[model samples]
Each structure stands twice: as C-alpha cells, then as structure tokens.
Target: MSANIENFPGTPLSQADFDEGKILTTHWKPKLEYGWDAGVAISRYLAELKNGRLIGIKCNRCRRTVVPPRVVCEWCWEPMEAWVYLEDTGTVNTFSICYIRWDATRAKEPQIPAVIEIDGASRGAGILHLLDEVNADDVTIGMKVQAVWKPAEERSGSITDIKYFRPT
Candidate 1:
C-alpha cells in the first residue's frame, strides 16, 4: 500500500482561534444524585463508632488486628476471625498542619491531620484523622493521643463520631 501524506485534509487551529471564540462549543450543567451503602465490615465498624467504641477485625492466621475492619487480612489473604475492640488512644505516626480548608479557602486556624497508629492494632495499621488541642509547633511523631468523642447523643455512626484526636 502507498501512503498519501499530501492528501490529508483539515485545517490546523492556532491558540488565537480558541482565545477569540472562533471555534463553536457547547456548555452543559448536569445535576446528579447518588447514594453509597457501606457493606458488612464497614457497617459494623460504623455501628461501633456510633456506640463510642473503635473496632477492628483480627486475622488469626497473621495474628494482626486491623482497624476500619476488613473482611479479610490484606497480608495473609485469609478471612478475618473476630472483631476486636481497639483503644481510641494511639501514637502519631505522622502529621501535617494545613493552612487551607477542604473547600480550598484560607482557614483562621490550621487543621492538623495525622496518621494515628492505634494501640491494639498491628504496627503501621492506622487511620487518618484530624488532631486538635495541641500547638502545631509541638506536634511530633510518636506523640501519644486519644480520641475526643462527640457526646453520646451526637454520635452518628461515622468516623466523625470521634471529633478529633488530641494529646493525652
């Protein structure tokens, strides 16, 4: 087969064409709605959170307990054995002080986000949550912290049930 490079058709556009609105375009605004069903493991986890407790699943095969309970052990690929109650207390594995809000606006008080390694869970297995009641300058890895839970009446079966973690 012979190539016909010279027969190619269509005009190349320049930046000025788009900038000056030479090209035709359509605009759209879509309204969307959605819902999520937290399955077995997470449903149980959230229920425990609402009741002012932290729960995880234990993998008897690997002898590791994981928070935000999973149905199976990520490492051993075995079914998780039982639900374990984890302490709300943990150590700061890492942290960050943010000057902006989730909406991209400036914040008067910086938010402290951290990975907390829960006491009863396997090392390096933890949750990402906000920190409070401590100076940003004083926040450090290995710092001991405890969950500051919302009042029982305010608990809502969500991670936010624990308002934040703070230095213990």
Candidate 2:
C-alpha cells in the first residue's frame, strides 16, 4: 500500500523514509471485569421498564423524585422508599450539542445530550439521556421532550435501553 498525503499536503508526516507505513502498539492491557450491581433500585427499574413504566424513586420526606433511582433523597437526605412512575414527559433543564466522542464507545458523530426534568419530578431532578428526532439546530434550553422506549423485549438494564428522547 502507498501513503497518500492529500489531506495533509505538504505537511511533514513521519513516513520513516520507508516503502510503507507500519502500525504501532503504544499500550495494551488485559481484559478484566468491573461492575457494580446498583442493587434493588436499578433492578426494579429494569423490571418496571419491561412493563412500559418509567420508574423513579421518590423520597418520602422531601417528596422529590430522583431519576436513576437513588436509594436516598438528594434534597432532604432521607431514605427514598417509594417508586414513582415518571410521566415520560419533561422539560429540558439544559443541554449541549456535543461535537466530540461522548465516550470511548459512542459513535464518531456528535450527539445532543441533555439533562431533562421529567414530569412529576421536582425541578433540577432529572435524567441524562440523548435527544433524537430533533435537529441540533432545533434543540434549546427549554424544549419539551418525551421518552421513546425500545420494545419491551429489547430493553436491557441500562439507559440506552430506552433508546433516545425526542420533541414532545
């Protein structure tokens, strides 16, 4: 194979003055296992998802519903003991159209990620998920949105299992 320098024309690229280029192994690590169970709350959340329910736990003391199902309330610092069905509707608390790799596993294309305050939950209590079915130009700070869940059988015990949210 030959090296074509069209993109970086006239730029000094290290070709080693050789017939062809070679790939390098800069670093390597052994595959390993690492995980947290997230326990009953998340487990129950997954189960609820199977039933087409968006479940968040509410703090009985503060009455604030926390998405991602925390076992404790972020406000009153009390134990969260009630399961609440989020309305699947929400207002965008704030958002950004990220034009970079959101994570090591995300697609090369940029994604619109937002913190959404789902209905029936207190302000500032929200979930982080991707926004779809809307253009980056259309996304705004106060936009209303709703969840679009994957088929029940396709849901995993993870956020992506919800697919993405879109304008309501």
Candidate 3:
C-alpha cells in the first residue's frame, strides 16, 4: 500500500536548517514584573514563616482548618478569623515528577513537587512545595515529610522561605 504525505499544512524545516538560521525567525524577550499583596491572612502567614513557624485559619462555619490562611472561607462564605499554628511536618497528598526546568530546558534529574497536607491543618488542606534530598522514585502519596526552612536571616516572608520539603 502507498501513502499520500503531501497534503500537509505549512512548510516543515529540518533541525539542521532551523539551527543554521536557514528559516526566517524573530524572537524577543518581554520584561515582565509582578507584585502581590499578601493581605491580612497571607501576610501574617508569610511573616510567621520567616519566624520559623507555620500557621492556619479555621472556617468556623464548616469547622475546617485552612492553610496558607485566607481572609475568607470559601466553604461557608464566612470571614475566617481563628488562627492556629501548624506543624512543620505533613503528609504528601499528591505529587508530580518534573522532567523539565521552569525555563523549558530538559533536566538531568526530575524535580518532585507535592501538595503536603500539614499535620495540624484540615485533613485535605495543603500547600504546594518542592521535595528534595530523596530520589524521585521514592516519593509516594501519604509519605511523611517536613519543611526544610532557609536560614532565619535569609528568610524574606515568602513561600520560598521553606526551601523545600523532605521525607521525615
């Protein structure tokens, strides 16, 4: 049997031709910046992180503890006010193995990121953070983990304050 391969869309260029600049191409990088207000809850949350502590808010209506504390509870549409300290340790709720870097470059080793359900927070509440100091293949749901915070002086009231989570 014969195949018809000519009814394609646009022109196709070989890797060598593209790499050699045989094809006309223009690219430009955009300078972008972003600013965010942590607001009452999150600002306090990040601030506590800088002080080597974790905190959460409770939704009085649903009685669910919220992590990365928010100003309002989405569950009951009620204003969240009760604040509580959370444990640095938690369980991995879910995860991903990143084979590419943020810049889209191939990575030699995978980056493991997971939503860790903090021990003192609601059962399903978690914050997304990276994992390190362990092989990627060893990561598993429900795996116990703990935050590895940066040095106190290096903290800047940001999520990155906790460098990463590692198996406990």
Candidate 4:
C-alpha cells in the first residue's frame, strides 16, 4: 500500500507530522501468525526438544532430512515422508561476525549468526544460530558446533529452544 501524504484521510499532514508517526511505529508489534503446517511441526519439534533430541523430517523423494522440519521437499517439491533425528553437531557453512547488534533480542555481547550444515543432511541444507564460546578472531567457516539447549523449564517451540551453539 502507498503511504503518500496526499492519499491520507482528512487534511494532508506535513513531513514533520508523518515523520513523527514513523518514529512512533518503530517499536510497534511485529506481525505474527500460525498456519496449519507450521503449527503441527512446531508442536512436534518442541516436544522432541524437551526429550533432548533435535528433530527433522526427511523428504521421501530426495532422501534429505530437513531441520526445523519442512512439510515438503524443498529440492524435489514432494511431501517429506519421514522423521529423522539430527546430530546437534554440524559444520559451519557460512558465518558473519557482527560488531554491531542489530536486534535487542540478542545478547549484549556481539554475536556471530551462522548457517550450519548439520551432519547427515543434504549438501547446503543448514540451520542458523548464534555461535558462542569462541573469540571472533577464531570464528571460521567449517568450524564444528554443538547445540546448547535452554533449561527444560524455559524450552519453547521456537529456535530459542536451544540457547546457542558452542565449539564441538
């Protein structure tokens, strides 16, 4: 939708007034949703995490397991048919050391968000997480890591189920 002042209701607001509205909305709530497919997978994953397991679904056609599980094969476009247990340990596919914190949800310390290629999964298939217990200078592609989970009482159905990753 267009945000032009001329299309706004009633009198046109000045640039300063429009800027004021933008500033106010800067902290507005983010959009949230729970579609049918996502809900089922999330419920299952969370239950598995509570039992100290990392769960993912495997595509019947491609024989590739996907973490945070997908309802279908991303590569072959076929329904994922089986459940698989993934090793928390994986090689870092790509990573970035951030000197600046982009979101308040992260730790006060600088974080390195990485795309980790989990063991036994298809090439390039990966999960993103913050890398911990290492200095920024030591961070490198292909570094192995293991998931550090949150306390059982603090577990949730989201990525936050794992607190972070540490050197393996």
Candidate 5:
C-alpha cells in the first residue's frame, strides 16, 4: 500500500554531507518539585491506615458506606453521616494476572491485581490492591482475602501501609 507521509519541509541530511564534528548536542538534566493536599477524607483515611486501621464513611441519604471516607456522598450529594471501622478481610470482586511491572519492566512471574470489597463496606466500595501468597492460576472472583499490613512503625501513611492481600 502506498502511504502519503507528511514530511517537514527541510533540507535532508545525507551521510556523505553530514559531519559528526559540526553538530553540537547538549545534555540537560531536569529538576522539578511538586506537592498536593490530600484533602479531608483522604488525609484522615491515610492517617488511619498508618495506624493499622481501616475507616469509611456512611451516607444517610443513600444508606451506603463508602471507603476512603468522603465528606460528601457521591450518590445523594449530601454530607456523609459518620465514620465507620471496616474489617481487613474481604472478597476479590475482579482481578487481572499481569506479566509486567508498573515501571514497564518484565517479570518472571505474573502479578495479580484485584479490586477487594472490604467487609462491612457498601457495595461498589472496593479498593484496588495487589494479591499475594497464592498462585496466579488459583486467583478467582469472590475469593476470600485479608490485608497483610506492614509493621505499624514502618507505616508511611499511604496505601502502601498494607503490604499486600493474601488468601484467608
């Protein structure tokens, strides 16, 4: 198939006419700084996670409990009622067996990623995390799992507080 290629109007450089010594290339190292506010819900959620506890919020209007405790309910558009403690053990709603790492690198074994529906949380209130301590072929929907948290002292007030989820 013939293809029409849009070439930038420029004099083409040929091997015979191009000289390595005539071209100047400078290397640049980029430096950047960034920060963000976690906001009320996420900040409290992270703090609770750092302390080895899971907390969520209840919406009176919608009659639903949500994880990562939000100040306002997404469904009913009202302020959430109160905070609620949640169990670490949960069920895997959906999952994927991946053969690549987050950094675009390959892996010898497949990694299992799943959406865990925390016990005592509302429907559709699942958290995304990796699965461990099980074979890739054994992972299935509705599988029971529990959070394997890092030591409290080593907790960094982030989702990484939980090392990974393992079968119960």
Candidate 6:
C-alpha cells in the first residue's frame, strides 16, 4: 500500500476571527516532579559534609586526591582507589567580592566567594564556596581558612552543612 503526502498553505486568521472567538485554545498548568541521584562519589562526599568532615577520592595511579570526589581520576583516567578524609582546613586559591546577590539585587554587604584548595587534596583540587567573618579586602590568595560548620543538629547532607569558610 502507498501513502499520499500533501503540503497545504496555512490560512492567516483575521481580526474578525479573533473577535468572533473562532480560534480554539485552552489553559494548561503542568505539574513537574523529579528526583536526582548524585551517583557513587558525590553521594559519599555529601554524606561526609553532614558529618562535619571533608572527603576526597584518591587515585592510586596518579597519587592525586580530589575533593568533591569523582569515580575516576581526571588526570590518569583510572578508577579512583579509595576514600580519604581530609582536614577541614584549606587555602584560598582565588576569590571574588560581589556586591550583588545571586538574584541580582543589591546587597548590604559584599559576598566573598572563593576556590579553596583543600590541604590534604592535590595542589589545585578545590571547592567553590562562600567566605565570611573577615573584611572583603582582607581575603587573598594563600589565605588559610577553615570550614565553619552549622551546629550538628542543624546539618543536612548537603554542601550548605558547612556554613562557610572563614580565615583561621
């Protein structure tokens, strides 16, 4: 059996059609729901955060430890060997002082965000998080800092469990 195909030109609607309610339309409100799995590495990492500890994955091949752990070593392309608990201390590798909130509203005080190189991890492996408890001008590369965790009862298994990093 053969099927027939045809191309048809569209007829433009006129103002009279709209006025007469000839066009058909309906309102719709969709409900969207979903769940996310952080996978093996990140799940363990986040769990450790809630416990007030930092964890990293160690790659035996490259002898590199990475924070916010990954299942594979980025440098050697090998499977990570084991989990390593790291000190909550780190050094500020780089930073920014923003006067605007994440929503783009003006902020009363500047938000200082920085990439902190975990002391026990590889030289450059770091996490991006906010810095607090010090003047914006006082923040600098190589500044020693420590994670200020939320009270144990207030912690949830998330990065926010570590309230922020502050100069030690």
lDDT of 2 by residue, 1-168 (tens): 247544654645466733354544356798998897868788888777777777888887777777778787767878888888888889998888886673556566678889998888777888889899998898998899988988878876567777888998
> For candidate 5, what is the lDDT?
0.90
Q: Write the per-residue lDDT of candidate 4 for residues 107-135, one digit (tens) a residue.
A: 56677899988886767789888898889
Q: Model 6 — which ten-residue stretch has the worst lDDT? A: 1-10
- Best candidate per lDDT, number? 1
Clashing pairs in 2: none
Rate residue 127 of model 3 by lDDT: 92
* lDDT ranking, high to low: 1, 3, 6, 5, 2, 4
Q: Can you tell me which runs of candidate 4 are displaced by over 4 Å?
A: 1-37, 103-108
Can you list the residue pairs that collide in candidate 4? none
State the lDDT of candidate 5 residue by residue for 53-148, as single tens digits. Answer: 889999988889988788999789999868999999899999999989889899888988999999999877999999999998899999999999
Q: Candidate 2, residue 127: CA error in Å?
A: 0.5
- In candidate 1, stretches whose alpha carbon ends up further than 4 angstroms from where it belongs are 1-25
In candidate 2, which residue ranges exceed 4 Å CA deviation? 1-28, 102-108
User: What lDDT does candidate 6 reach at residue 149?
Assistant: 97
Top candidate, metric TM-score:
1
Error of 6 at 45 (Å): 0.6
Candidate 1 lDDT tens digits, 1-168: 247566666889999988899997688998787788898899999999999999988999988889879898888999886999999999999999999987999999899999999989989889999999999999999999999999999999999999999999
Can you tell me which runs of candidate 3 are displaced by over 4 Å?
1-28
| lDDT values, one for every candidate | 0.93, 0.80, 0.92, 0.79, 0.90, 0.92
Better of 2 and 6 by lDDT: 6
Alpha-carbon RMSD of each model: 4.9, 8.8, 3.6, 6.6, 4.6, 8.0
What's the C-alpha lDDT at position 30 in model 3? 94
